[model samples]
Target: MNKLLKYLLATILAVSFINCTDNFEDINTDPNGISNQSLTQMNNHIGGSFTPMFLNVFNVTPAWNYQLQQGLLGDVYSGYMTPPTPFAGNVNNMTYALVDGWNGFPWSDAYGSVMPFVLDIKNAVELGNDPSGDKFVYLANIIKVSAMHRVSDIYGPIRYTKFDDFTTTGEYDSQETAYNAFFNDLGAAIDGLKSFESDSQFVPFDMSSLGGDIAMWRKYANSLRLRLAMRVVNVNPTLAKTQGEKSLSSDAGLLETQDMYINTGFAHPITVISGSWGDVRMGAEMESILEGFGDGREEKYFNPASDPALNGVFKGIRMGIEIEAKGQYGNHSSIGSVIDGETMQWMTAAEVHFLMAEAALRGWSGAGNVKAHYEAGIRTSFSQHSVSGVDAYLLDNTSTPKDFVDAINPINNIAYPSDVKIAYNNTGTNEEQLEQIITQKWIAMFPDGQEAWSEFRRTGYPRIYPVMINNSGGTIDTNIQIRRINFVSNEINTNSTNVNTAISYLNGPDNGGTRLWWDIPGSNF
Candidate 1:
């Protein structure tokens, strides 16, 4: 085992089996002193194996790891924040030039930290004597789907569906195949969990906001099923509708009043934005949209700029700018305390409402009409952030995205892309209704820019600004923006044949310009 796998095994032995369990620590003692026969009775490690899988997907501490895994990639591409640091002489990912070193973290973290642990849980459950272990198998599958979907979204294909087999573990699955596997995994997880709805074994190990309520986990699984279903709506409408309706009609419920968040022991990673690193500032789209609408959540989401020229105004950096130094845009508005809590938002009630709204627009059965779901989404978002004046905000239909004026660089200023309003546009066409649903969903799912970026690619709503710098050197079109990042060089170095096979699955060359399987290249309607 290499260092990462070694670290994982050590962590499982030290923390997962002992600290994460209810009373495994008190019972298991003197492993070295015990004879071989005594060790066979300790099946406690099986239950504890899930702790690392639950936590590593989001990654709690040593925040810089998360900076590489998500903050620098998804968050930036989602038009949430832009880095001021001119890393590698401004030819890094912020400028559309792929950073091989930086891009490896998201992949390595998933395969190394999440996948191996999930494999362990599955293997241990299969070997265990207790039939109740089936519940844990279901739970592990849910975690696997949650973690791996993000990985599959980032790269067009991934080493899923065959990860358990040594001979085929290195092979890749196309995005469509991966998504189908996800639906199947989540479907089986939900059905298996139903029999264990009253089982309390999960409560001791669950660190999410759901508190190990099996019914609520069922709900989250169903909601995630809905999310994945919508992801492929444009490419695979029949499958999308089939899976989506199953979720909507299920009595297991959805994440309506409650939000899904992970309770990591440390502070949220947004501290890396506002703190000494000063690496990230608000994105130009955020400044334009939030300031234009006079959205009250602006105060909740970001702090005013430190630049005296802007006079404490909310400013944001446009992505892919030619920066000589960090000081150029470092003083712009930093992300605020909204993400400083113990938990980070995964899925929210507001987002679910918006998903339903889109489903309604598509004429899906269980989702209500476009108007009600759209308005409910906004209201739920306002309530989630504890921002008031929603009634007035919702009534005002004239507000639209304002032009973004960069505080430091006037050359970077640009006009807003769309005039889509805040109020529900019932008279609008299906495309217009979709724009309304996805745009609000984007705002409500703040800070978790991975999902936001994915939805933006799918819908192209709330038009995002294109890159100011095209360091991709013709591999990526600056106007089209980056569609998906190329496979990290680490895979090429370690698993060259598999990586080559994966590239063959791409619609185009293995570059940022290539669209994934689900990202249809037309109007959403």
Candidate 2:
């Protein structure tokens, strides 16, 4: 009986071992590489990819890179267009449609990517998954404010408050309402971040090389707060001052470390659509500004004058802004009329410092020196960014308009004589302040030049040169220039009511000529 029992036990053990081997945790219920969940993983991908296309940093899906196209025309900045020649058609071609197209540019953006970044921040905070949740909240507010700033500037008022509800039913919010919400969101973010003290204990998924850090996020948030305050130009000066104070105070936020900047790498350009210069050229206004500052970034930004295109017939008609004018060096298609998206340039350190200086000048209670911030802004532009050859530029200090004239023959060697006035006045008037801020901001934002046009529209400084060809309808008021962009066909068909409601707030029809409700002079005075 004992021998029989032992043999039975052994058999049972053998059976159990066989069963364990058969069940070896190889559950095919789910698979690797491909997963049911994609939106979460791809949200940052979309944000990082699409956001820079408008700014000319990198190119993704090339079908709808029109934001950069219209952005240049609206601001009168040169962009990536072929042949590098000026336009002859009416303004309706570029102004009404091209500029207006940017108004609804965000339409084609993948909801899966943009929505999750904003939503997950709120979700993770509520779920209590990480200590940096408040930082996420801060980022959420920054993202909303920055996105809205762009959308409103381009299209006019947009869906706010209920913006996150687009998954169910998105509602368009008024400019006033949007501004109020923008202010509230930033205010709350500021408060939350101030009280946030705990470091996220979990190992961060190695964004170190990418320059993602908490302190940097806070700094970028504060800089955004300052930018938003400037938008309340026509609403209430007292409120603007109050917000400005909040942005500049010791309690004011900033992306302190260099690690916080959005770094550009050779590994991948966030928004390069085409790899050749056939798509872009240097704008005259940008050339004027950089030459004025004796900026050293001209070599990388500009093409040489001896190219076959710019010499014989086309002298003043190069595309791309903040870079020098040049004809194609070697049939470079990427250097066309639009900003090159394949090029890798992101937010600059000079931008952060410039924002800090602007905040300090606004009388915020921070430890930074306002003047030093301005100087640092210039220094970084020469030192860190890809623009090479500075010593020669500074020796010239200011270049006159005639200095840019290219020779008329082939082998057209373009040696520009110095002729620009660099001493910008700080104490002239409110308009003066706005120009100084925007001009520096413009200098800081190269490669990604969409913001330059946006800033030009927002404040109307650097009175731009009208197209040599009178293509635009007389609607772009000589004084005010292009005001708002027309609503796109996509929005009219999909969100008609909201689009109409938003349109009504615009002083004119939703076309490019209308001044947004916030742009008119209530507090802009």
Per-residue CA lDDT of model 1 for 141-218, tens digit only, reads: 898888889988888899999999999999999888999999999999888889889988777567689998999999
Cα RMSD, each candidate: 4.3, 11.9
> Each model's C-alpha lDDT?
0.83, 0.48
Range of the 10 consecutive residues with the lowest summed lDDT in candidate 1: 35-44
Give the Cα-based TM-score of candidate 2 against the true structure: 0.70
- Residue 205, candidate 2: C-alpha displacement in angstroms: 5.8
Per-residue lDDT tens digits for candidate 2, residues 352-411, read 676666655656556377656766676677665555554454344344333334233323
Residue-level error in angstroms, candidate 2, position 22: 33
Best by TM-score: 1
Off by over 4 Å in 2: 1-103, 110-112, 120-138, 166-168, 194-210, 250-252, 256-277, 305-346, 359-370, 386-420, 423-437, 470-474, 518-525
Q: For model 1, state the Cα shift of residue 472 in Å.
A: 0.6
Prediction 1 global C-alpha lDDT: 0.83
- In candidate 2, residue 377 scores what lDDT? 71
